[model samples]
Target: MNQTSAARPLVSFDGVSKHYGSVVAVHTMNLEIYEGEFLALMGPSGCGKTTSLRMLAGLEEPSEGEIRLDGQRINEISSIERDTPMVWQSLALFPFLSVQKNVEFGLKMRAIAVEERRQRARKWLERMEILELAERDISQLSGGQRQRVALARSLVTEPRILLLDEPLTALDANLVVRMQGVLARLQKELGITFVYVTHSQSEAFAMSDRVVIMSQGRIEQIGSPKAIYRSPASRFVADFVGANNILSGSITETGEDLKISTAVGEFHCEKNSDRDFNTGDTLDLVISADLVQISMEGPEVQNSLRCRFISEEFVGSIVTIFAELEDGSDFKVQARQRDLANMALEEGAAFFASWNAADAHLIGGNGA
Candidate 1:
């Protein structure tokens, strides 16, 4: 989305790890951030996303392996020496300084000419559309305005790479959306690599060219938003990515397609991967909620189940129907709100659930 290419990467992490005493904050992460690419690092708390970002920023040195910038080793470099600028989640700005002065602070520290610094600051402020607020105090500006100022400060240096650590966390929902646009525009216009860190999956998927999902000090998967969401590589990814209904059962048939027998019923899944399964082998099934079809009439489907309706929730234009199987396991079906109105299903009502063979995926048959 940001005019990023695969020909050459601007930043590379080769088997990088960071540790603090007995705890391993980051464990052997290998990643590449392409030039002009908008990459997002997303995970739960203590998942080592922030630690990985810090290592790239030179705020933390890796305990092992190398960190490279433009093919140059930078593991021994300090934050000040690097060309990467980071906008912290807290937006660490000088509270007492006016917007103009705050934006010029980085230029001043680097000893750029006074006139040049002011001119550059004013230009960036104009580009950010906050030139009129140049004299406004940092505390006096709105959350969105302050966010722009923080970005202006980091970007005024025109670094080859920009780093953001949840810069919109403190903003309200509307402001967060607006800020996402600002970042996307900046990256596209400047054609610079952006490394963004956040805990929100929606934010990551909306802004990044690729999303690096981390868990427990390891990188779970790195792929485009669509690939990561549509075809999760593991059970943890499937469960964490979205509202997926995971079923555990024994495989009755194998090869190109698989037959799984569970407490609810016997289901067929399209074998989408090279991983093989044998007869009577236990396997886990990942079926995205939207893949589950809801219909008034019982139609033929490769995988169908008689489920009891537990509940239904309407979110905007989509409706999520919650159901339970005979085994008491939870199942969910997502459908358009308009369609659900005609289905006419009530609590404790029984409905038939069905999915196509290709909709189900076989993952981790041996308790993975």
Candidate 2:
């Protein structure tokens, strides 16, 4: 919350890499995790997210590079000795143990006095809103309740860093939403560093201060969710972070702003980052389907293009219209039903799709 104090990262991954014989689980990872920040590592399966977390937890050693915590190197630190606690997906609570006992398991292992451990466990259980179930058996608790108990168990020790590995995957959708809020509030209240791993974009965007999008054992991009979504650094990130219609195009002009010529038309794009582009350069443009608007009649808009409606998909509040350009290239546009009703569109109908120049992002290479 306080940017001044949070300027310095609490954990730094300096050119870290981990290899398993012929396989590279993590390839030259370099990252800075700020203190009290909730950072999420997101990617598809086998993208080194779990491997990276394992290396941080000292469960696996990096074949190359170093890991630092609070300015001290922690690559050699053992899992139990490090000033961090991990919450596994399984909850890992003993089936026969009461909620209170399960929550205090770590403290007891550390040789804390029984009374002190109970006091701490009770405090955390109450904080997690599970005090009433302190004596309930783990098997009797619901998925959400078990998750809270596991969190209380981890937080009871008051670790400076918390590592969560898809801790909400087992919960239902409604409960997952509820837990996302809980985790967000907990991070703000505790002011502790949290490194979370998940494959869910909604979860990462909803709860993280910054998101690290990983792909094939490497980081694709690292930034706030908005930046990552709006201005992805690479094609992989652009496609992964959200719904995008990736188009192949060439740069017809380059200067103060970029002008790309695609199958549909030549369009101008906002210049935010220093991306190299020149006339006749090939590039990719990622435009979100939701950002485009469709109308039966063409609007006098700069980026508007005429297309034929191929199909329509009704999804809750918005309808996704699939359309094809004169060149036979297809893209999707999402509009509310009321907006579509205004157009009175039909299948195989002619329509114009348009978006702001600023809404399109240039990726991959200079559009030629």
Question: Candidate 2, 240: how far from true, in Å?
Answer: 0.9
- Model 1 residue 345 CA deviation (Å) reads 2.5
Alpha-carbon shift of residue 143 in model 2 (angstroms): 0.8
Candidate whose lDDT is highest: 1
Off by over 4 Å in 2: 1-6, 255-257, 274-276, 366-368
The RMSD (Cα, Å) of candidate 1 is 2.0
lDDT of 1 by residue, 146-213 (tens): 89999999999999899999999999998888889888988889988899999998899989999999
| Alpha carbon deviation, residue 212, candidate 1 (Å) | 0.6
**Clashing residue pairs for model 2:** 251-367, 251-368, 280-368, 281-367, 281-368, 282-368
Give the TM-score comparing model 2 with the true structure, all chains together.
0.94
**Local distance difference test values of all predictions, in order:** 0.88, 0.88
